[model samples]
Target: MSQTDVAQANPATRDAEVLIVGGGLSGALLAAQLLRLPGRRRILVVESRSELGRGEAYSTVELGHTLNGNAARMSVDPDNPDDLTHWLTQHIAAGGWPESDRQHLPVSQLFAPRGLFGVYVQQRLAEAREQGRARGSSVTHVQGEAVDLEIDRDGARLSLADGRQLRGAVAVLATGMFPAARTPQTRSSGLNAAALDPWDVAAMAALDPQARVLIIGSGLTMVDAVVSLEQAGHRGPIEVFSRHGLLPHVRRQPPAWEDFLAADLSIRRPRQLLRALRQQCHAAQAQGIDWQAPLDTVRVHIGRLWSQATDVQRRQFVRHVRPWWESHHHRSPPLSAELVARLHGQGRLRIHAGSYQGLEPSEDGGLAIRLRYRGSQESVRLAGDALINSSGIEYDWRRVARPFPRQLLARGLVTPGPLALGISAAADGAVYDARGQASARLFALGPPLRGMWWESTAVTDVALQAKALAARLAALPL
Candidate 1:
């Protein structure tokens, strides 16, 4: 048999210089950067979704699910900061936007719809693939879920759900955010199939117009639920419940403030850092500047701060300060903020601070929810037509029911990270095995790196990580 015969014999085994699982923003951007580097190689990106860049977050068909950040700040290219803005301008021009309407569109600062942003990402990836092909490199996008990874000394074998095996020099796990996991209380509760996914616009709209909705989280996801409901013309009252009852602050483009915390090494502990941050915020407020200025400065050094934290400090931060930090740091888009405010003012939305006890069947063919009020020991009961689990991404790996991750844990290909936030991996993206040793053939990026970088989910952060990972992979002996 000749080489061609052998190739035909092993039809299931596809070869690639690099194999990336989960072709969301992280994998797609990494493929783009790697193809642009000074070498030509074959890159394979496997995604379950039909679209390359749009995972669950951006693939929504609802136009009302807009991006949380502005186009100027959400570019996929770190080197070209205004790439998305420029792309949007060209896109609008190509779409034949009237000249009078062009000025009204703020490509730089406006929050584009999430679906449109997904298109922008897909377009960029397509361009990158074209560039790679022009330079003797190649990119292949396969629509499938990667179920398992088999590792050896030379490389790793990826098993897809459709019984396909891909052999590559290295494998990268870019599995994006997981769906919200119900708490133990929710599991034991009799309300089965009662919790609706916040992103299910059709199902949410199918509810009765006067049905009361109980949202189980007050973070950005809850905000998204609100936007979807309003778009579907839902006139029912919306109730948001969370332990802290803190809502995301509205996004703003503030002037760059001095990064005072970058040089403050003494603030190593979470308590010390929080105190210092408060002082900075107060000083900025006293000077008639928004507290966001000081918080923006902290973003510059957040990675370093998170990396330097001790295990105890990290745990303490999660237990005591995570809620406040998330609400303040990850803000809602301007349009979303305005809509939520108007709804609240109109008495259509209400937020409560409490703990969800359980759910019981209501007399009116709905669900009755029990909650322990924030300030009182007495429980409160609320009746609603529907409940939604908008509690955001469940970070704890032990709790997630995803099959691939569970398999990885059972085989000891990866270990849980600190605080069980995500998979354990080095800062350089080399994944650790059951024995806590880094593997050369296996790597990870994006949300799975939350343990290493607390703020790894943002596009900007993922872009930076992709660039660095591409550079490091380029230097590796392939």
Candidate 2:
């Protein structure tokens, strides 16, 4: 059913029928699904990291770093809502992750550490691999970065950073989100070079215990940075600069509110939806219920609402409501949020409403930065012994300074997505090429489809996309 090209470099071993450009959560989930089906085709996954499931999000070793959502909501199996919960239950029963008892929360609502979650994902992939092995199907991990790709009538040829090449009938771009602090940018902001990685607790530990630390952005990432600082025993002042100066709300398992979006079809515009949501929250709060109850209902409808909005409406939403929406929807975990709240209340973590201009010359032998406060035109200067650019992920592929994205854009292999949030792709994750043609051999999912699906980075979002994309690839004649 699948046509795979033979690798001339090694005639004895046939090339993969499907080549995944990344081996992160999205790639691993997709591979697991593809392997589960009754097929004898070979699959190849190329990743720069030594591990497959621990992408940028899960690679952190800190136990303080937890998933944004709880186990019930973070399932890799789309068909089974309690897949993660069940796995976590068995995992705990086996005396694994004894740290999970701190909160005394149930397994369903317990927030698993990102490192442990990576283990769960890897175990799932391992099970799929064993199942595939018995069926004569095989999946191989190519430990290299894919720098370039060429697609022709015959198949796809991928060139890696180590001068190795792989050919396959179909190739999927599962490259996950590139964090702003780590990824190289087209226009170098000396910030990344000077700032400490938000997840790097070891580097943070090396700093002075009382060193004033400067931070950028006040979203979930900023919360993580604060957690890292606490773990590193750094107790100095933290200055956070963002345009809105807003922090993410804590994620909660609130009572289920009525699905108002599904019941009412007339509320299509962004403004209309906002008004209705406010009423729902207000109503819920009036009844002594959690305000998050109503907001939770909107998660399932975001895809339809985002995809159907006009370009003008989309722009309006981005300019007017995006900040608020992000802070509310993409919330922080309870423990992390509590730490942030405590720090903020103690005046140690001060949030300044402003736009970061750039680095300024330091006169006191420390890193200096300047930013214009929200309502003022004049710039304010601040200096600290250490800095962290927790400005979030870099989704725009064009601005990424990596060799692969640069080569893809230069060769006209793909185009920028809507609002420049990721690569352009069709409804079913088929990548749109330079001329707006959906390539049959190329597919994408997860964060790469951020522009396509407004809420594409969550675990549930990636799992759903992985399942659908796997089914499509299996049914494809190519």
lDDT of each: 0.82, 0.90
Query: How does residue 359 of candidate 2 score in lDDT?
Result: 91
Q: Give the Cα error of residue 123 in candidate 1, in Å.
A: 1.5
* RMSD (Cα, Å) of model 1: 4.4
- In terms of lDDT, which candidate is strongest? 2
What CA RMSD would you report for each candidate?
Answer: 4.4, 2.5
Q: Model 1 over residues 1-478: C-alpha lDDT tens digits?
A: 1223222323234498789998888888899889888778788899988778888778887767788888888899998989988987887778722331422546787677888888888888888888888888888888887888887655778888899888887788888777573332323354326787787778877888878999888999998988888877789899999999999999887777778776677777778888988998899889888898888878757778898999988988999899999999999987788888899999999999998888865787778889997998999888888888888886666666666787788889999988888899988899999998887778888888898889889999999999999988777656
Report the lDDT tens digits of candidate 2 across residue range 1-478. Answer: 1233222223233387899999999999999999998767688999989998888988888889999999999999999989999999999999999999996899999999999999999999999999999998888999998999988766778999989988887889999989999999898769898899998999999999989999998898899999999999999899998999999999988988999999999888888899999999999999999989999999998989999888888889989898999999889999999999999999999998999999988877889898899999899888889999989999999889999989888888789989988989999898898999888878899998888878899989999999999889888653
What TM-score, computed on C-alpha atoms, does each candidate reach? 0.92, 0.96
Ten-residue region with minimum lDDT total, candidate 1: 1-10
Clashes of each: 0, 0
